[model samples]
Target: MIPPSSCGVLVVGSGNAGFSAAISAAQSGAGSVLLIDKCPESWTGGNSYFTAGAYRIAHDGLASILPLVSNVSSEQAERIDLEPYTEADFARDMRTVCGGRSDPELSRVLVEDSGDAVRWLARNGVRFWLSFNRQAYEVDGRTKFWGGLCLRTPDGGKSLIADLQASAAQHGVTTSFSTALVDLRYQGSDGVVATVRCDDGRRHEITARAVILAAGGFEASPSLRSQYLGPGWDMAYVRGTPYNTGDVLELAVRSLGAQTFGNWSSCHSVAWDASASTDPNAGDREASNEYTKSGYPLGLMLNAEGQRFVDEGVDLRNYTYAKFGRAILSQPGHLAFQVWDSQTSGMLRAEEYRPERAEHITGRTIEELAKACADKGLLDAEAFVRTVHEYNEAVYAHRRENPSARFDPSMKDGLSTQSSGKRLSLAKSNWALPLDQGPFLAVKVTCGVTFTFGGLRVDPQTAQLLSPGGGKIPRVYCCGEMLGGLFYGNYPGGSGLTSGTVFGRRAGRAAAAAAAAVEEEGDLVRS
Candidate 1:
């Protein structure tokens, strides 16, 4: 709890970014740091707890990356063929994924500081392990880890949140859960103070020298989703916290004159199980990120009309999954089914097989699978079978032309169907395999929005929220999903957590410095 009088620094939200700011501020010599969040302490980590805990960082090779993991067996280590992910590769991927519209300044900090930032997290007691199940494929007795995403915090987001909370407590930063920010009271001579809505439904005035708003975006508000993200967005299921109704973003913009940047229509959404719950307080950790159907690249997506609507293999799933949600939402009925044969069923993440959470069906043949999907009102039985047959013929034709080519899931191995008149409007550019294997599976999916891309703009150097006139908000800094401009049309996998840590560190240090400056100048005395 914050002292009734005042504090040196105040950090709002207890997610990775908020905790990062609080810990950093305390380390920077802030006398009193208070961390506040609207969620109860038991469920207070924000959407950070819903993450898979993947952190994308630039590393030379396995030798440089292996140390970050808390544990690794010699057998598992020796079988891994990990490649280098350089800073250039990270930058290129970020730009290419977002079509070059990513904020240059913010993206630079994310890419350049990602390595050290993750290391810093580990040093502060967050444990990580190679995301073996998500990032690796066992090929020829060797486990090959592809994509820039390799490390994940132990037990995924749950562990990451727990550890960060423990670390914050150890650093002498007081935390108050179920405390919502009512408003910011700015006194010209004394700087900014905040009015908070405490757990007991009473409002309290809290004074602080500096405040950092790491609160998240407006993904939870249906009306805001429709107004800002455009038509059909209100129906989208929220993948994380429901408390992130954009109150902080609105406060910073309308009340504090913060500049809003990034594409309002763009967001970090994913292909989520259609039956997933919409409640943020839904205590089902399995229903969190596990509901995501991210293995589309290894399979095909069929719309309600039994037609392919996207080039599922246009790129690695990491680069393409975020945008696929919008595509699914655009499909008829805002639904789609990801279909895969037995050849690749084992290839999907373990989450897909979770009986309690996944909406999956199995059939002995394509014909049977199509019928089963039809029974569930997911597709037209005949049309789906016809589509499968045509796709198979194309796959066979392509294989005959290049007999030596093979299907490799770890990378795009030119496993494509032949260009023919029967080709659907959208085609799978890579990893296109015939659904001839028995016991084929299909999982119904819809869009699950993770976070909004639009938020209060901030200076990359100091992490201070920027005004519309291009000036800092002085003592107020911003981080996490609240700090927009890094992402726009699309997102690179694992970059969210990396960004939270990077900007969180900068914002924490800056807020602490601002507090020290006020005290040193004797302009406004600290209580």
Candidate 2:
């Protein structure tokens, strides 16, 4: 096989972040840009293809959202009521969800520039729509959107990947799939050399004036998951591509002395169907994130011991879903069951109701539910009944105190239960309801990881990877899940995609500038 020598800018991993970097580099005057991915052409978008395509942007109201939303008729815009999600709210959400571990500078940049980053994607041909299916619900006669999550890439992650790749192609960005990076060698003031293996089993060295590593985190590799995330993480199902084996992270940190940040044990995980496929490349994939049971916030989560492990109503699903996976993993048998009644069952996302896809159990009464759970060998029947009885007493007491109060699923509507003398270790913060309603529903789930948080620390300003000595690594930059210090402990939903665009754009511009400088100073282009 003939080996191509070099390019102006090389982007590793052709997902949202990689494509964003390549397109921006090409548009910013870089003559040649190439993006390579380990996956073949069919599975090339990385984890972004599995995402919900949601983007968290800081906007003032429906009026300000009009410019960003696509195909919104004036009549529909006037009819919908969208609460303002300001910059302050964005920063507060990041800090709160990460347990105040997020870097202040990175948080500020993400919150302040999120709107512009989203608009930039829209300008680059990625389409957008109000997240009607996943985010909002209809109330009375009108549509009311809540949770500060309004924008989404239409048709979900698959469509987002298609459009971004199309934009990359339109702007003359070259893509090489099935090319895996094996090693990276940095030359002191010269540049970085990437050793890659192509589909033909041929190895080649590709040198570039600047490198933007957006390959992703270590969630897919079982060994890395066990090494960084601790003991039982290797058993958890991955919600994304298996190709993110921490190659770039290892090369940058161990080989180039890059500093790493964020909580290594923490990652963005969720309660996924225990029946889901562990194979990322499986064509008949049973649980490819369509199995995410996010409706636990509207119900109760009981572990195998027939005990509640987490306050399911502590916050919106967007704010708490990422961290609850740890709770599920810590449970006995590494499983949890989300129990809901007919009252809120209809409110669940359509994904939860797929007959062939979910591990669902239904019963007409609480006792029957316990029997069904016991029949499945998932929980103790007596212990489950006792737990339900105690919880229902609390709900009844709370309702008796406020007879006129009604349950609202749109937001944290202060629907909570009182202990009523049966004190439990964990308390439901809000949306607490009784299981007295018949025909109860329960879905079994285990922890499913999305992406690891701990990664190479970088300067958020230029997206340049920083060294252990607190200096830039010459011409190397990083983006996406590989850029650390922005999230820890937990992650607010939709921030991942938004941060990818923000840092990806910045890294691309910086990389293009660096490549141009090299050409000017040496008066020679290494092709």
Best candidate, TM-score: 1
Q: Write the per-residue lDDT of candidate 1 for residues 221-246, one digit (tens) a residue.
A: 98899999999999888888778889
Clash pairs for candidate 2: none
Best candidate per lDDT, number? Answer: 1
Which stretches in model 1 have alpha-carbon errors above 4 Å?
1-3, 278-283, 419-424, 523-527
Each candidate: RMSD: 1.9, 2.2
Tell me the lDDT of model 2 at 101: 91
RMSD of 1: 1.9
Please give the distance, in angstroms, between residue 470's alpha carbon in candidate 1 and its true position after superposition. 0.5
Model 2 stretches astray by more than 4 angstroms? 1-3, 71-75, 187-190, 278-287, 419-423, 524-527
